[model samples]
Each structure stands twice: as C-alpha cells, then as structure tokens.
Target: MLQIDLWKRVLIWALVVAGLVLASPNLFYSRVEQHNDAVKAIEASGATPEREAQAAAWPSWMPSNLVNLGLDLRGGAHLLAEVKVADVYKARMDALWPDLRDVLRPERETVGTVRLQPSQPGELRVRISNPEGMTRALELVRGLAQPVVSLTGAGTSDIEVAGQGSDIVVTLSEAEQRATDERTMQQSLEIIRRRIDEVGTREPTIQRQGTDRILIQVPGVGSAAELKDIIGTTAQLTFQPVVSRTSDAETSAGVGNEVLPSLDEQGTYYVLETAPVVTGEELVDAQPSFDQNGRPAVSFRFNPSGARKFGDYTAANIGNPFAIVLDEEVISAPVIQSHIAGGSGIITGNFTVEEATNLAVLLRAGALPAGMDFLEERTIGPELGQDSIEAGKLATGVAFALVLAFMFFTYGLFGVFANVALILNIGLMFGMLSLIGATLTLPGIAGIVLTVGMAVDANVLIFERIREELKTARGPARAIELGYEKALSAIVDANLTTIITAVILYVMGSGPVRGFAITLGLGIVTSVFTAIWVTRLMIVIWFERRRPRTIEV
Candidate 1:
C-alpha cells in the first residue's frame, strides 16, 4: 500500500455513490414518464355505431411527456393568434355610440331634433333634428354639469362634443380606445387560458404580446391542428332571427326535426335573429352525458339571470323552435321543450361522445368576439422527436467515446482513472436531470458533449502537476499531495468563469438556451468533484493496493 490517506478516498467514493443514489429516482421516474399518455378517454356511448365511430377518436388527455419537446423533434402545431385590435376597436366604437346616444337622446331631442354621431376626441355631433326642440334641450344640457366640451364644426354650426375641440366624439377618448384594446387583449388571454386548462395538457405556455397577439406552446400536445381550431374559434353566441319551416325551404333542408331541428320553413332553415337575445357569457357549466334513452347529449346550466331570461323566452315562444347557434352554425334548436324554467337544458342530437365533448368544451370556453380568422398554424409530429433523440444519442456517444479514448491513451493509468470519473460524472448529470425534471433537448445534449472535453481538462491539470512534482524527488504520497494542492487554485479559477457565464446565459436566455445553461451548470459542479477529487482518491487507492517504486505518468 502506498501509505496514503484512506479517509480521503472513502469520502471521494461516498460523494460519487451518493450522487448515484440521488440520481436513481430520475431513472425510475423517467420510466413512468415514458408510459404516461396525453389523451383523455370519453365514456362509451350505448349506440354501437356511435361508439364504433368514436373508436378511432384518440383520447384528448395525455398522461405522459410533461416536458415540452422541441419543434424539430416533435411534430406539433404552432399558432399566432392576432387579437385584431382594430376590428375590436371598431366594434366597441359601434356598440358604445348607441349607449351614449341613448344617454344624451332626451336632451338632444328635447332641444328640438338634435343629431348625435361619433366624432374625434370623445366628440359627438349634435344638431337640431327639430330646431325648435333642440334650442330648448341645448340650453338645459349646456347648463347641466358634464365632462363634455362643445364646439361648432368648420362647414356647419353643429355643436361638437370633444375632450379636445369641435370634433363629434363619444365618451371614449384616445386613451379609452387604447384601454379598450388593452382590455380586449387581456380578456382574450383569459379565455385562452380557460380553454387550455380544460384541455388538461402538460407544460403549455400561453403568453400575450403587445396589444394584439397571443403565443401558445403545448409541450406534449399532439393535435396542434385541433388546438388551433379550438383557439381560433371565437365561440360567440348570438340571438339571431330564425326563419321557420316552409318559409325558407330553398335555404335549408327541411329534414326530420330529429336530424335538423333548426331548419328554415319549407324544409329550409329560418334566418337567425340578427340581434342576439343574450351572449354566451351567461353559461356557467356544461358536460356530455347520456339521456334517459342512452343517447349522447350535452347538458348545460346557465347563470340565474340567464335561466330566468331563457325561461321567459321559452314561456313566450311556446312551441317555436329556438336555435342555439355557436359561431353562426346552429348546434341545436329544440322546440321550446316544455318551458325550461330551471335555466338548465339538454341539447339532444345524433352526437357521439367525442362530438358532444367538443361541444361541451366550446360552450365551457365561451365564444369569441366577431369572426376570429386564423392567421398562422404549425403542427409538430412526435416521430421527428424520437429520431432526434436517437441522433443526439449517436452524436453524444461519439464525442464521449473520443474523450474516453483520448484520456486512456494520453496519461496512461492516471488518464484511465480520470475517464472512469468522467463516466460517473455523466451518470450523475443524467440522474439529477431526471430527478429534477429537467427536459433534455438537443442543445442540452451538446452541453453534455462539451462538458466531456471540459472534464478532461481538470484531469490533465492534475496529472501534469503530478509529473512536475516528481522532479523534486518526492515520494508518491508527497507528489500526489502537492499535485492536488497546486491544481486546486487553477481548476477553481477556470471553472468559476464558466459557472459565471452559465449564470449569465440562464438569466438572459429562453427555452432551449436555458436548457443548455442548466446542463452546463450541472456539469461544472460534477466535473469539479469527479476530475479533481475522484482522480486523486482513485490514484491513492491504486498506490495503497500495489505500491510501485516510481509513479509513471
């Protein structure tokens, strides 16, 4: 035995073995993660044909692969949903004008046929529709306290109400218009958030940018095609005028009311009421279930006010077929079905569980404003990801093999000792990534490859120092002792700079950059122990077991 400290060797081995123990959980957890599914299963419908039809429908609930796969490797969809701020602003302008007109209608008319219309700078144009009445109303309105400032237009002497000058404007100023746009973006994001939550996918990110766009990322979501369909749909519910059977036969197929309850007259569908009775905002909850006859149906409950409104409408309509149109397509139109006084009702149709589920999802998600057209869509497939993993492993193995060969040939026995430490360090990195749930991406693999070469540098420093120490004619014990002590300062100084760079990268990076940073950071710490400490301890054990007369580099 080369009379070296056994305690130091034992401590070094303890760190390595403890790392293995700590990392073991990641291996076991990864197995479970691999087997997890991403799709949800719907309960079977009793209709054999319907159930058979649904047999091909994959479950929406995915139970595994929580970490996001990169776009190149995984085939998934990507979409950029533009909020259409200008369109929203226009709609808001149209909707708010009526309310303002009504609020000031009495005064404007009281002043004898005054006209009120939208103008610049919260401006409104008010002229005498009835000159005699307008004169009386204006005197009262001018005296009444309000935030409005009145002006006369250039071409005509019409009174202009504006925050700025004589422009006919509504209550909404430039700031308010911007605020409305901002609110639309926020509300749209909320709606998107709710929809994604219902999807039950893992690691999905939905972020808002500026005043008009939303970015969504779903890690393991396979059906990005369907995801865009779900997100792009505004889901707006309207109370439109409906034409009955026999009235518009040419416009629609007057099928069995069972097949098409919402057809117009003459076996055609009715023109839906252009003015909505109530929006979809009142819907509280929805679920897919079987009716008493075991047929697929969507059961929905409304808010108290919606329930009362629905009841009133049904009670008045009697046997009229009322339509439930979502995004302009009639989903269901049951004949006033015996007065749904409870504010809850069922939509019965020839629907499968999957069909009913999608409806439930849309209803639960509420509707979007206007017609939200899709701007962009991208779908990713998982086959590519698996192939990338294989390729990454190949490249990593090649680099590691090269490192192993170089180390074994370069320093001879001491190099062999460092190579073993390098292998353990890689294992330790893997185990920790698994344990901590760090996703391994292509860039992360690159970091691992780079670390393999880096780990060798520490060994080289120690081995070269040991060779220089031998010139002093010291014993093997003293030579190794001086070598570790001398290499410590340089090793720490070099790796500290790396760790600092890694910290900066992590702070400034996003997604894959962060993944690379994490791998690099973990590598640096493990390399310090394995390269500096592990090698020294292993060499000591070698000396103790077979104490050689002269240590060869």
Candidate 2:
C-alpha cells in the first residue's frame, strides 16, 4: 500500500484537479451565469460593443453549463391540462366525407342515392334511399380501411363499418383510436415544447400524465396565465378554394363546403371547400412583416411539397378566389391574379405589431392536434423559493460541519484525512451534477446531507479494521493493506445497493423525486471514490514519508 505506481498516482490526482476545476464556477455562480447569458445574446444577435465587452469578462476555456435549478427552487408556474382527444374523432369523420362520397359516386344506381345523416359523435351515418344497397355501400366504405400497425392491433383494420337496414355507420376501431391518441399526444407535446422554447426560458419540465392529461412546469415565468397565453392559440392555418361569397347570414352551403364568417369584413361570409389546398404544417418559416398596404402582416414560406401543390392549384384556377382561413374563420379571399409559384405569400390582417409577432410565433410552432382544457394551475412565488434555498443552505452547512467535527475527534490524525476526502467528495458531486446539467431541488439538498453522513462510513470501517489488525502481530503497512482489502467488499456492496435504489426511484418517480434520485446517486459514486482512493492515497504518502517504527493511526 505504501509503494504506489506512478501512473495510478497521476490519474488519481488528475481526477481531483478536474473535479475542483469544474466545480469552481458554482462558487462564483452569478458572474458565470451573467457571462453565459451575455455570450448567448451575442451569438443570437451580432456581437455589439457592449456584448463583446461582457463576453470578455468570462474566460473562454471555462465551463458555462450550470446545475439547472428546479421549479421548486427557482419558482415558476405549474399547470395540468387535459387534451380533448375525442375532438379528433369528429374531425376525422368530417374529413372522410369527401373520399367516402367519391368512392360511392359511381355506384349511385346500386347504392341508391347515398346521403349523410345526423349521428352520434365519432360515428358517421350514411342513409341509403333503398335498403337493398346497404351491403354494397358498407363494402365500399370498408375498402378504404387500412391495417393497424400496432402489435396488439396488427390484425384489425383502422375503421369499423356496420350496416343496419337502410343506414350504415362508420366509426374508428379500437386500434385506430389508440394510434390516433398517440399521435395527438405527441403533436400536443411537440407544439407545447416549441411554444415554450420560443420564449427563451430555462429548462422546463413538460411531461404526459395519464392517457389524456399533461403536466407542465416552467421555471422563471411570472404566472401560469403567461404560460397559457403563449401556447393557447390553435393557429390552424389553411388555404381552401372559395366555393362562393355571400352577404346573407342564412345562405345555404352545399355539400362538402363550410360557411365561415370573415375575420375583417363586418357582415360578409365565405363558403369554402372542406379540403385544404395547403396547411400550416407545410410552412417552413414565418415572420412579422409589413404588407404592400403598409399594414401589419405575417410573411410565410412553404416547403418544397407545399410549393408544388400550391403552384399547380393556382395555375389551374386563375382569376378564382381562394380563402385563407385561420381557426375556422376566413381571414381573406383574394383572387389569383396570376400563378404563384414561389410558395411565399403575405397575410394582411387587422393586427397590431404585437399581434403580428404573436401570430408569427404561433404559425412557426405549428398547430395543436386538439384543444386543451386546463385542469389545474398554480403560481409559485419567488419568496417561497428564496426561503427554500436559504433553508437548504443552512441545513447543508450544519450537516457538513457536524460530519467534519465527528470524523476529526473519532480517528485523531487519520480522521483529518477522512475529512479532507469528505470535502473533495462533495466537490466532485457538484462537479458531476454541473457537468450533466441536472436540476437541483429541495429534496436534493437532503440527499447531499445524507451523502455527507454516509461518506465517512468506509473510512471508519477501514480505520477500525486497521486498529484491530494492530492489536494482532502486524506491521503498519500490512495492517493498512488488510484493512483496505477487507473493507473493499462492504464499500462496494453498500454503494451499489444505494445506487440501485436511486435508479429505481428515478425510473418510477417524476419532478422533485427525480431531482433527489440524481443527487443521491451521484453522491454515492463520488463518496465511494473519495473514501477508497483519496483517503488511501493520503495514508500511503504519509507512511512512506515518516517511515516510523511505531505509528498511531
């Protein structure tokens, strides 16, 4: 144990140096955070003189990533929302009408005048004038169904078709509903993430709860209302062919067309084709811009596929008006004066600059799959967060001091070695947490305190074992070797068991629970490393330098 290899000594010291270097930033948290924010600002906008000066304040080689503080520590908004998954069913049925009608059009004689009828939600009811053709109509509709892709639903088709006398009802099958729900949840999650990220806030936790619920926690936001405002707009933009223009409120809209009130015009309404020529999903970018009329407008550019489709439709219907609709309201109906091939257009609306900017943000984020009903909302104040931080700091300092004192008094000079290792162990823990960008919560402080107490356990075991070996006929170096060798198994078993428990907690829990697991797991690892390697290295170095015939450990 006294004769350590050159390579091993270098590696161990290198790790200690790296830990201290990485953990140094947190000691001066405010300055580093400011430097990081300034660098980001400079990167976003071309470096101004002020920003360049600010960036120079912090060294380039220093690590900029900090341990992100959780909502419980930083204070923010928490919201629980339920996605209206059922709304998609009604939309699916509406969209299927055009295809269903076209498929049965050729068989009008056989199907006997197919007509849509009032039905329950999620069910499409089509009445046949003659009951004799019900079977053939059902067959035609069923032909449109596609096979479900999921493992549990591999054999079933996407739609279920049934016929009763003269009427046929079509509804989404179990497999299709499951697939649709998954898609809706994913879309909702993505859109929410985009909306939040656009605002340039710190790490936000957005996760799915049960089947239909979502939990959102955003740090640094003032209120839940602010968060809601950013993501509330549906912003479903679509370009549809205008079927007709009308001033009468009660004007009849024919089959496969919808009548929507004009957004700007006082009393005008437009009947537009149900099928969209292009959707917001095709948009690649959107920005707030001024139109030719010097009014607030949003400029948008479409992707390659959308450009091709838009160009073809515009070329075919020159001089015909097309309606630009947003959220089921017609924003404008402008005639195609000429072919628009570039897939870039301007939307002129009665909007303020702020409104235009918000619209651009929403359009860039894409539309939500379905509406969300806010089930619960909470605003955590900064005062509470400050109090929690103070409490955590006090608790950590007290625990650290007590652990230091206990180790020093218990093992004499050897106890001082353990205390040094204990301090380094904490530095390494913070270094790891900072490196991984883990969030720190209130419970995480408790985990660190528990780690401080547990870190000395291995050192205590080794020292007591050494004392026991000394009572027998053994020299200092051999007793030291046996002590470490015997304690190795216990240290490995204890730390591994704690780490496994932490992993389980993290996998099964969320939010604050995850924060505790992360700190606890990292603490266990750093503690074991410090107690086994660091303390042992100190003992070996001392033994070699002193070369004492009789030593008191």
**Predicted candidate 1 versus true structure: per-residue lDDT over 337-402, tens digit per residue:** 476788787777778888888778888887665344457666767887778878988988998999
Residues 1-553, model 2: lDDT tens digits: 4567889989999999888888888887777877887888776546888877777777999877778777888899999999999998887887787688889889988988888877787888888887888888888999999898777788899899999788888999989899889889989999999999877777899999989999999988999999898777899999999989899868888655779999999899998877688989899999999999899999999999999989999999999999999999998889999999999999988999888888999999999989999999999988889899999999989999998998888888999999999999999999998898888889998898899989999998899988888888688888888989998998899889999999999999988888899999999999999999999999889888888776676
List RMSD in Å for every model shown: 8.6, 2.9
**Candidate 1 residue-pair clash tally:** 68
The whole-model C-alpha lDDT of candidate 2 against the native structure comes to 0.89
lDDT of all the models against the reference? 0.66, 0.89
Stretches off by above 4 angstroms in model 2 are: 45-54, 112-119, 127-132, 163-168, 245-269, 284-308, 342-361
lDDT of 2 at 535: 92
Can you give the TM-score per candidate against the true fold? 0.68, 0.90
The 10-residue segment with the lowest total lDDT in model 1? 254-263
